[model samples]
Target: MLIDPHLLAVFTVTTIVALVTPGPDMLFVLGCGVRGGARAGLLATVGVITGDALYIAAAAGGLAVLLTAFPVVFTALRIVGGAYLIYLGVQMIRNRKKGQTDDPAAGGMSGRRAFLNGMVSSMANPQTFTFMVAFLPQFIDPAAGPIWLQFLVLGAILIVLEFVADGTVGVLAGRIGGWLRARQAVRRRIDAATGSVFIALGIRLAAER
Candidate 1:
């Protein structure tokens, strides 16, 4: 086995706990679902997964080493990412009124836009890369096989679990949003709530060392 069985089990449980905790990515997906629909939600998940896959690849390629060697670079990236998220949150809040239209086509974000938003949001979070670098290595066992292969295996598992959890949240949110679409007031509240989540996440990310 590329990874120790015991370590793998522990990692799985840890990942589940982490996923279940409401975080930026999950909340972003929820916002997308509420604004768009089920299709947009699922596409957003795909985009986020794709971003994670890229980060895994980068981590396997020694990006962690680069980050460790230049802490300033990481700091700069973190600040920029946090700023971008904040900008997005503010935009959402400002545009809440525009999203009050009864026609989904007119008010809701398109599927392509949702996917891109998810991808951009995921990639913009330097914390994701930092987390991958810090978290994935614990389960690796040099005696088991190649380190890179182990990273890939662990990354694959993480991605699958993320999809399962995030996808469910998106779909469920989309359904509820659909049901409540008739109420303009509800729509406004949903937009405000989602935007607040994004702003809070951004502040949290920016503040965290």
Candidate 2:
């Protein structure tokens, strides 16, 4: 086995526990869902997964070691990412005011944009890179197989689990958002709330050491 079965099981359980907790990635998906709808939410999740795949590759290649060694780089990345998120939140609020929801072309959140947003958001999160570097290696066994292959296998398992957990949250949030969108007043409120979530997340990320 590329990974010890017992270790794999333990990793799976630990990952599931982590996923169930409301974290930055999950909250970001939830915001996208509430802002855009189910399809947008799903696209965002895919984007996040794609970004995660790249991070895994980086970790396997030892790029994560370089990143971790440079505390300034990590801090700079977090600040930039947080600022971008704040920008997104502000834009969302502006779009709400402009009634962009009624017109797809008027700065409405499109699927491609959602996907890109998710990808960017995921990549911007330094914590994800750090987590991959710190966590994934715990289960790896150099004696079992090629180290890179082991990383891929473990990464695949994590992505699948993330998709299931985060995807469900996105879809459910989208449904609720869709329903609320039927009422104009409620729709505006939903937009505001969603924007707030992004802003809050941004602040939290920026402030985190």
**Candidate topping TM-score:** 2
In every candidate, how many clashes are there?
Answer: 0, 0
**Whole-model lDDT for model 1 versus the true structure?**
0.80
RMSD of 1: 2.0
What is the Å distance of residue 172 in model 2 from its true position? 1.3
**Tens-place lDDT digits, model 2, residues 27-97:** 99998887788888899999889989999998888888788888788788778878888888887777776
Whole-model Cα lDDT of every candidate shown, in order: 0.80, 0.83
Write model 1 residue lDDT over 6-66, tens digit each, in one string.
9999999999998889878898899888867777888888888888898899888877788
TM-scores, all candidates, are: 0.89, 0.93
Q: What is the lDDT of residue 92 in candidate 1?
A: 74
Q: Which regions of candidate 2 deviate over 4 angstroms?
A: 100-108
Q: Which parts of model 1 are misplaced by more than 4 Å?
A: none
Candidate 1 weakest ten by summed lDDT? 99-108
Residue 41's C-alpha lDDT in candidate 2? 87
